[model samples]
Target: MENHALKSWPDVAPKLVAVAAGRAPADTVLKGGAWVNVHTREVLENHDIAIAEGRFAYCGPDASHCIGPDTQVIDCAGQYMIPGLCDAHMHIESGMLTPAEFARAVAPHGTTSMFTDPHEIANVMGLEGVRLMHDEALLQPINIFTQMPSCAPSAPGLETTGFEITPDDVAEAMTWPGIIGLGEMMNFPGVVNADPKMLAEIAATQRAGKAVGGHYASPDLGPAFHAYAAGGPADDHEGTCEADAIARTRQGMRHMMRLGSAWYDVETQITAVTEKGLDPRNFILCTDDCHSGTLVNDGHMNRVVRHAIECGCDPLIALQMATINTATHFGLERELGSISPGRRADVILTSDLGTLPIHRVIARGVTVAIEGEMKVDCPHLDWPAHARDTVHMGRALSGADFEIAAPAGANHVTANVIGVVENQAPTKALKAELKVQDGLVPGDPEQDVCQIALVERHQATGGVVNAFVSGFGYTGQMAMASTVAHDSHHMIVVGTSHADMALAANRLQEVGGGVTIWKDGKELALVELPIAGLMSDAPATEVAAKADKMVQAMEACGCTLNNAYMQHSLLALVVIPELRISDLGLVDVRTFELTPLFDEGQDQ
Candidate 1:
């Protein structure tokens, strides 16, 4: 296989010197542009950049001396030449596309670099799966640095996974060429409490001279948060409010404010820089999870930068948050994140500063995109057959499996419900009074209460753990089932009708794995993510088309939440607080314990 890793700066330094000294001709020269200097936070006009060996050789007022007869010169026409945007933290699988396809989709939006955590795949296929993601990431035209997944079963004892990422796995991944750091250490409690395994994994990454990502999902800024900070996580992206951002940066961690498809955190958190006057250098921008439809219709990191600006951030500061700040957080500032000499020649030409329009994009000295269209080919991996056949339901399910039997002739009960908050990651733990129907507790659509079941797909045990959920506004006999459940990657079915839920679950099992929606006992939409049941190998536009139909189907079922599919996928994420359902049982995340579904003592 061809190694797509870029040549080191030292390996090509002599050539760079020769080109800068006019001893050799440059391969390409971008002339007559306004440089957005991130290092000094200034826009200098009439700047020209010379490239050699896919690295910047000269960036000054004039590079005419480096230009030879054969050099390819492109006039920038006074466009704002900014460093190519970078996503500090993201997941390729969240796009429902493989690394190659995700890169192809975002490259056109001027995102030349991404630091992705492949933890989703690791939960399903283990180290081999992570290697597949890392190898494919190295083949892309843009930079896709892999973070070794630190938490497979994100909350160790709270949930079960197909595979567990051990300390040895973390050490082994550090040897890979594409690995940048350890992925977000979702096990915050483990770190704070000094669990040997979690500490060992962090130690291995630190010993290897890589960044250790953080995921302190709790809202508490008490001793626990401080202990987690003291445990050696260098950066965190789970901050949702200004206080969270302030606390993180105060503890010397980069605060990565994210704006993904469902996560709207930048607006509330960016105020730490915009209003409170915190140093902008300590704040970074990222998209923790954006699906294919968002990538195709909206933008990638470009969208984040624009959103930050819209949230009252200074244009130059927002650009820095997406570029130099991110690169610096990952210890990659010298290799990328700027248009400086010795850095990779990743630059974006845009006409505006605030409402940025991607006029052209250049990665590794190659023009990869123009006018919101891809200009270069992103290579794909030959996925094995085992990856496509991961859904193991043991046997076909029925309405009986989904039935929530009343506790020995009890007519009424106060049920613990998982409440979905719109455009947020956290859920509210709610209590609702539900009545029994024919010796079984039934979901009431009028009160917006619905049945949620976690069907264990990993072990094929055919185990179904039932609970209740609200805030989807779903009505009628509809059910939605997804194999892309977070952390555990089990099958999560939410519906008002047991039969439709059964139909949805069976449909996903039959198609290997993916998301399926059924209403009135008929299939409404299906976005088949056959690869490990997390992502598809299809093109972004194609997958996005199906995702659009899926969204329409959700709307038709009366779901009013923004990006309800993302909400559905995260119903099983035990790391986040309040309540969630897992293969084990209904999780009370605030206390990190399994709680019963019905509380018969409480009244409505």
Candidate 2:
């Protein structure tokens, strides 16, 4: 079915005029409700909201004149009316679902707007994939704006990708109906260094007067960070601390504190406004990378707002951050931020503001979700079959393929290990002494060190780089493999046993790249993400249930890191600090240099 439900006020205004003048029918009038004014942080009681032509025509203490012979009126019983929640920065692909499925998952959560970046898909399927996401997003029941993917490879020479995004692509996407801005500028180093390509993309977004999203993952508050700020990114969601939030706001960039499925960064950073008392207007709430499990089971933007309230923020202030602050940041304040005139009539009804439970959701003056269930039809996109068969390893891999032969005559060695930082995307550059057994480096469960490998799948290049990682609390013979590796879409397999690791990695390749878990050489769970190796066409419920099993498998393997799968995916990500693995070799993010897996006479 086609989705043509604009619910614009133009069609409803004339009827409201008649109701005001006693001539025609009024659609619906909500009376005796408390207007939770986010702009003033006050609640005005006993107000009546007049609806006509699918818009809120008049809102006051009394709209008796708006009542017509055929008018339908409902007494709200003094329920508080709040604006619909808005997500400032996110990637639908991060939900591991297509735009249609992502919408289906979040629509019930009173989330009406989303600024999504499709770079995850672009890295694997290129421009066509990005356009597919953009088009499908616009067809949803609510506003789903697209930020043209800015960085496909993420780091130009650091890692390889199935496809690359060019400057020309950025310029043309700005003309698309759903295009809102450029995706996160992950090339922060390049921007600071005046890279011509990065500059060109920024210029195109600037020329269109649209927002330029940011991803300055570095904690450096020095000249390098300053130079990146000067490069035209208007907002950032990578900040993890109060200082990171303050630094961005001080430099005229919106500080987006996000609370996603795993990245619980809001509490640490929201202190900039809640305690340090920076202006809350410059802070925005978002879900940087929400998985479908979180979206379907928990709320999206609404969850972020509730998290902010729990983080010592005033409920009203948090709502403003989630709504008006987000709208103003994207230059859409006048259109969607509040209940002001000419704005889209997207509002929510709840009994309390602090524990914001959405009893009803009205978007564009149409009841979309009632009691946390979608009441309207959310259209789906006709996804092509090619998106379901993307995994292409030239051939099946064996246990021998995963074996990392020790250097000639090397028995013991110290190796560079990628340290997993719980609840954060960044890794640590660590040196660990490892034991070499039978000419092969092995992990020490006592040391919490495990083997990490990146198998290059972009060009079918038979390249695999092996490294080490800590902080998983892993204590068994198990492995996990996923194609959801961030930025660079390679397959990263991590395990204590090379046999299980090889089995898990080969399982994904056997069924097309997705996520897989192996325990003592047995397949435990799998999610086939064939769409650019990042998303599945399965329903959110189905995917979340499967992902739950994967999470359970991780737990069964004695892994105890928070959201260990998310930490695993960053194994091949070269942007974040301190150590990472690519198809080439282990990288020291701090020094950007290649490091060996072992040092002489040290078990690493």
Model 2 C-alpha lDDT per residue in residues 110-188, reported as the tens digit of each score: 8888999988889888898888898888788788889999997888777778889999999999988788999999988
User: Per-candidate RMSD vs. true structure?
Assistant: 1.1, 2.2
lDDT of 1 by residue, 361-398 (tens): 99999999999889989999999999998999999999
Q: What is each predicted model's overall lDDT from 0 to 1? A: 0.94, 0.83
lDDT of 2: 0.83
The lowest-lDDT stretch of 10 consecutive residues in candidate 1 is 1-10
Segments of candidate 2 deviating more than 4 angstroms = 1-3, 7-25, 69-72, 599-604
Per-candidate count of clashing residue pairs (backbone under 3 Å): 0, 9
What's the CA error at residue 189 for candidate 1, in Å?
A: 1.2
Top candidate when judged by lDDT against the true structure: 1
**Model 2 CA lDDT for position 592:** 61
